[model samples]
Target: MPVDSLPNSILAHMLAINNVPPPPLRSLPRLRLSKTINYGQLNALCHIRGLKSDQHSSLRLEAHDAFIKQYPQIYLHEKTVLPKVPHLADKRKSAVRLAEKKHQPAMPHNISAYLREARGGPSIDEEEITEEKFQEFLNILKKLPVYRTKHEHNMVWKILKNIPALTSQLSKEDLKILSKKVMSETWIKASTVTGDDGLYVLLTGQARRRIKVFRSLIEENDSIITSLYRDSFLFDAELKDSTVAQLYVPSKKLTVKKWGVFGSLKGGHEMNESDRSVVTDYDCEILKIPAKEYEKLELEKVKHENAKKLKLIRKCPFYETWPTLSIWELVSISKFKTFPPGHVLVESGTVISFVGYISSGYCNIYRNIVGLVDLPINKVKKMKKRVYMGKLKEKESFGEVSILLQAPFTCTIITGREVEMAVIEDKDIQGKCMNVI
Candidate 1:
């Protein structure tokens, strides 16, 4: 047999052994398959392996499931095991639970039980006992009659002072343990507990080191406290402004009587009313305009001054005593003005006569080409319009640099379109700085 016909011959022999019937030549020609898969051989292999048809099918299914689980996408799989999904913490419920745990009230444990057990318990005075046992002793002392009497005499007494030479020997954690004992013992009977200051005083009895650290912490929170007070004051003032505004309207009489609630004073300017004890009356005429209008103008002025000061602070580097721009200086020289489109406020290489701050418009700052003025008509028409290189927008500053430096402007500053600006002369800024120098 030819090399290729050997497999067909083997297949014929295998088919003969298996007693498979031969088909017509036409049908036999169409039955081409892999020469390795002879039915008789396959049956013999299956018999030798002791594999059932159903078992083979089940093995194939398991192989596919294993492949999918192991490879996942076969494109991107996690290189490392991911952390197991965690139950999300419920913040609101957790906070409520924590607060309840904190404020649960310090009910004294059974003192009778403690006393009966204490008679047989190990003595706390043993020098060989650990620092942990000393802490326990301090906790027990807080409940004893002797310590309770000592605390009432001075509720804010220091704990470390009671332990001879403790300050030199104990660690910060030990001190914290002592503070906790103090907190629990005093908190139950605390009268006139106010703020962190009171807490510090009660903790350490105003120890110099403790008080210094506490003051630093309190001062560090100054900005946060200031922000809160500012918002609260503004809210109250806004309410008063609204009431005053409504009352002073054309058809109504403006009236508000001064009142007091303990130390709290109301009506008139708080400052003026503090010096006198009369029911101050606010009149529409006294304000020189409608109360609402006057208050609105005052608020705007105050806001403007604050913004200008903030800008100055941001622009200038911090010195030992860096100063903000004075409102009086701004008021004396700068005035808000609008420029029409194509208005030339300053020319290139010319001294900046008046520096302008963009209040409500866009302006371009660009380098001037030396030979652009000599361009031919055709070339000029073909040339691109000069690119606007830099833009100044609302609240953005420009034009002060050259004037302050007393030098010619290095670039041409042109209005992109209609613009509003607050103009100030170079001399005005110098005058303001002179006072500081």
Candidate 2:
């Protein structure tokens, strides 16, 4: 029979009636304790075993009583007489020695052994993660602490790249740099305000806007608490495009909070200390980038490109009569691209991708003309071949007529040397217009 099933009276009766094998050692839970990580887990495990969430035996007598109850058999020694002692007189005297048995429960001498047993002994089992849990496991990989700084940056960059709100505005290279400058953190206790004048992403767990509450209301469970989720982007969550970055799939059991950013944008994305504070409902993992630093970083990317593109866009004679506002719009659409010598910019009878303005070098125009084949081994035969035409020089534009009329280019154009051009592509980028012209 299991020791836990034994009744106090029956166990006593059995011990009194029969001889049994040596008493076995067992563990029982002790008092509840204020935790410390792995120590806390052990304490919680004790509580699950009907122990008081601690490993400590507060009173010596309590463990003694528990030990005796669990033990299958216990023994008491019989009293005995001692050997006779020599007397100073003629007679020797017999002495009696009293037998006394004191019971004491055995404790662990090796701390490591005791802890191992407590943690569940060495038949180490590894559980398999099922298909249903793959996503949750993937979320675990996103944790920054698991990887080194550079690796973590790359992981974050991958996530940022997928987010349409950032992708639509910033280049992949810009987002990569942004990922490196950001910081990630975790909070398990309710304390400080969230969104420290920065943008944030809650990677895991739940949290809520901590508002004021009375003790009575809390005790009665009548006070309402606003809950939050693993929102991929907060703090400027609503971008200039008016789209909120989303991550967590909404559970039918929970509703999303109507609040946009966790804090006010005016406060540089910081929660107002007087009335607003975001606290973890349990444990939370978050990534953040300071607002001021983010702006500075973005400006560096903008200024580097803007300085060059501004000059190139001004070279367009079509914009000579256009306003500065319209010129900047052109700058927004323009992308600086370079091509190696012999690279084809356009082909006759094919759609042109971009309206290009030559910034450096030139392009050789060609026409498909029916002419004799030029091969030494073969007799001359009439075939369609590329016939060299004139060249398009620096500051010259192409694809304007084709794009305006929505038709294919009339001639083929190939780069003469390593050529650079400021171009506006004629394509649909998720329905966003690329060329203002």
RMSD of each: 24.6, 34.6
Model 1 Cα lDDT, one tens digit per residue, 1-437: 23233234444543443356655445544334342344554434323321222434766455434433432122222368888775556776788899999999996786743652343211123344456754554454455334555444243234333432233333544443343333322322112121211111111111001000011222445553354355331111112332231110110121111111101112123322212111112211100112233344457766786566445434433322443345345545566678998777777788887766666678877776533334666553233244457766666666565766778876777788999776777777677744532
> Per-residue lDDT for 77-175 in model 2, tens only?
245889988774543222221111223446558775455435322211113324445344345345543354565456556655654434544578767
Error of 2 at 117 (Å): 32
Best by lDDT: 2
Per-residue error at 21 for model 2, in Å? 99
Candidate 1 regions exceeding 4 Å error are 1-322, 325-333, 372-388, 434-437
**Per-model TM-score versus the true fold:** 0.26, 0.35
**True-structure Cα RMSD, model 2:** 34.6
Q: Candidate 2 — what's its lDDT? A: 0.54
Candidate 1: global Cα-lDDT?
A: 0.42
Clashing pairs in 1: none
